[model samples]
Target: MRPLKSLVAASVLLSGCNGMPVAFTQDPVYDQAFVVHSGGPLPYMLMGTAVQWNEEYAVTVKHIPYVPGSVYQGQGDIQFFRHKANGVPLWRGYTPGEAVTAVGYNSLYMSVKGSGHALPAMVRLDAKEGNVLYGTHDGPVAKGMSGGPVFAADGKVVGITVAFLSSSELAALKRPDLASQSRVSIFLPYAEINREWGRYLAQAQPVTAAPTHLASR
Candidate 1:
């Protein structure tokens, strides 16, 4: 683990200000995933990534920071700039220190440059009972990474980015120096996500095309 940096970069949050994620691969899934937009204005700016769960709804973290009463908040919209995701639910299973990929808006307004890119990250599992399925690691998980999908070694969704360890939490673990290394943290392993969100998948309907006009015969 790396030494602690300033806490400004500490604590992973739910994801961002909003913009589309650039293409990570030619793979249809990666191509389809992009930042999703909602809400409005400076203070209300909000963004996150979502996968095409099925026809009706995409899977994303439930807690969005910019939404009112949320832990994180901001304002803007950018999903329109890129292709809306058509990704299927991710395949799951992971190990500590495993290589994983994270795709989301890293910047609040996409002003920070590299923030909107779909990048690779690693998994750092903490040895705690409650966090058994969940884990902590060097995210790179910035404000916009929430709701972004965490892909496994096989390149499938294993987790949805959720919360990260805070400076205080690190101190409690007696690893105060690791704050920097732990900065941009991640939680919400896919196993847990599937258990919770899986039920709805079956209940969902398939995406279908609109009926054609066929006006004159």
Candidate 2:
């Protein structure tokens, strides 16, 4: 996600003064979800742009007295949890160890076939306990599978199924050492999207109107 420099600057200006809570007289807006998908069975990660900022707040009173905006690009994986609806999330952590492929519109694809180099597999996890969910045997990813939704048992769209890993990468799996450590494909976390929801909304929101007194002065 891209960061908001304007908001960061505004926060800095507001920080200089302290007293009442400042209201963002304007409404908040956000952008559409952006994602990247992997080609095969490995997990996919989510990425987006955002604005980072520093704020000053009173220790006694839980309030933000100042805010600054600096724009930056942020990325993370889509994690799955049970308590929610669709597996899609607004924010989450980054999982670098997981191999990911780039798909259009911030979505990722992974595989599950054990024999194939990088096979795509759905990430089945216990929502309540956060345990790995698995099936009886490895499954093959079909052509039409790409872009299809990967859901938890609760029917949450945790990720989109992409492609498989290349033959060379698959070949590496033949080694007992590699097979133990690596999987054919990866699953993208849904939580990654939830984390940037605020900034995305802010970017889309209409800029607030300057106060009448300030405008006249």
Candidate 3:
């Protein structure tokens, strides 16, 4: 997720935020959740977006503040437990030039209390590096949309919004042709996300040490 320029007070409420563009709209499905970081008692900062996978679990990108398999205390008393990173088989069913939706909340585009802005996008490419897959979309992804989901045409989640390629990143990747584009967003395909989920789960597991000394009877 893109970092905030400055941290606001925990008490600062979201006010006077801009609305979504005319081309974009709101959807209840992706409005399942919005993640935040505790600024303090008075104010908290909006981090990114998440989608409810089920009543008990939700899916989001790995960059948010909350850890996988942890409790996500939402606005008020509403709470949801972050889904654990799993070895669930990777999903690679998306096709190029397919219609998709990128949904998430941005401080710049606040619509409702608990919902995210939805942008119509097209699948530009889906590239595989090693065992990980990254999907590229021609969506105008903003700062707060980082952890949002990219929904396929049939309303199935295909990828998690990660970052948009910067000019330098494109250069490094040897993609000079994309330089003219205003913005091209990148997403972690479910496969790459699965890979990271497992990594995060492993990291979060506590280390169990062998007994330093045996108990003497």
Candidate 4:
């Protein structure tokens, strides 16, 4: 195993939000997220959630199998376009430390993983249900959720799911024992993720109708 990389590692603890941790799913933050499929034999095998950033490209963890890279190295051999969008993207922003919701797309990868930690395939965040932001939560983020998005208090975008924290990584942080804290999903801050892809979003344009030309026959 290459080891998880986003769970409970390097986070910014926020305040004011409850910290009791809710169930696997009940919130609608997953509404803002869509299932992304990788073009492969098992289209659903390499699936995760993609968050809509604007009008052009949706965002997800680049490490997800949907992201183009070497699978042997855990870089996700497939891409994020095999599946189609199911709904509209989010249209709001998020605040730090506010209890939000999350949902994971049910994928074959999860089935193969033996339901690691007994967590559901979906994600959810709530204000009074231990849905803290900036760092910390007590839910459940399974293996296939690598590219999912973390929601804010009002169903807005906050962070993009990264990966689970490995034992060595947890030990380095001196926070060994990630038993009940399996839902402490780690995500890349929205601003940083934006900065990395803002230019692409700004420049990406949709195809429009072509204009007629006098020389055309």
Candidate 5:
């Protein structure tokens, strides 16, 4: 895996403030999976990765960012792209002020801090015109949320939840004396997975026998 620094450089180049807003006419191409630790079922979603796995089990590790204080109000959604194949869900669920890390393309990862819950939320917009694709409401980010998927209404993997900011960071951003800080969450582009799906599947070992045709997609 590439180091976080190297990954950030590439991500920055690929990251954009705009998204496409055309209504989705078809269901996502991949199936959604979860890596829950001990909860009934989370507001789970699906995501995809290019890295092949030794086993079919979901990738449960996560990287969170570092932030200072209570600037986030926890009221929005984080936007990201979905890989067409080998789609894996990136999990996001943290307190208003927490620190976490996330893995990215080129095997790079980064640490991020959350200011408030709202800061971690994403708003999918039109890639061409920058219009809203869809939005998710804010809710409590629980433990073991890492490695879970953030899904769209059509059940497509949009983005993964990385982490939240620390209390000090939030306070600093909210301070009247300081300029506003832009809140961010790290995510893997879904399209990237689509490009690398074969590579990942080749490396993945089935955890269980493939489900029956009716049971399986």
Candidate 6:
């Protein structure tokens, strides 16, 4: 079994005055994800990534840090207006060994020249539990990637990244063989996200096109 303290939740937050300007992707499928931030002084700093679940609702990992009494107070509150999301994607379950892309707003990556806020991470699904999905990717899991969406092969969002087990954590857990390997990202399955935010999610109705107006012919 893994050590209880193995998981590290991404908590690096950046505000506009202290970090890069907010960025976004042109692809609508990946654009559904957005950065979270505080409203005051550092209004543009990225707090974390969140996926648009509907016209009025978005889903993010529960571990993201938030300022007290603000719109992003914490898990207790369901309102998030610090930053805006571009679009919404469909959801589905994941299968082992399935190829997926995790889209997140990495703090360090965004600050670098030309890097967009929404990063697409290619990872292979490894396991699933009651509340989380486990996956392995080639590179390091950077801070601020938390709350990003894990998209399945069909472009559907399957999970929301929450944490990752670092190589050191593997050593602590007595898995020396895997200690030298890359980090294992942890995500909250889409189903669980729905359950966690059911009250608010249920309130957002699917958007419908406005009726076309035609002059009487």
Q: Roughly what TM-score does model 2 have, to 2 decimal places?
A: 0.28
Top-down lDDT ranking? 6, 3, 1, 4, 5, 2
Q: Which stretches of candidate 4 lie over 4 Å from their true place?
A: 1-29, 40-45, 66-96, 108-136, 166-168, 174-183, 199-217
What lDDT tens digits, residue by residue, belong to model 2 across residues 97-124?
3322212121122222111122223333
Better model by lDDT, 3 or 4? Answer: 3
Cα displacement (Å) at residue 84, model 1: 9.9
TM-score of 1: 0.53
Clash numbers, per candidate:
9, 76, 5, 17, 60, 5
**Candidate 2 CA-lDDT value:** 0.27
Candidate 6: where is the Cα deviation over 4 Å?
A: 1-7, 10-25, 39-46, 67-87, 108-140, 171-181, 199-217
TM-score of each candidate structure, all chains considered together: 0.53, 0.28, 0.56, 0.51, 0.28, 0.57
Each candidate: RMSD: 12.4, 21.1, 9.8, 12.0, 17.7, 11.1
Q: Which number leads on TM-score? A: 6
Across 74-107, the per-residue lDDT of candidate 3 in tens digits comes to: 2211223455333221234467677766666676
The C-alpha local distance difference test score for the whole of candidate 1 amounts to 0.46
- Residue 38, candidate 5: how far off, in angstroms? 12
Ten-residue region with minimum lDDT total, candidate 2? 57-66
Task: Report the lDDT tens digits of candidate 1 across residue range 137-163.
Answer: 454445766666666556676666654
Which 10 successive residues of model 4 have the least lDDT summed?
111-120
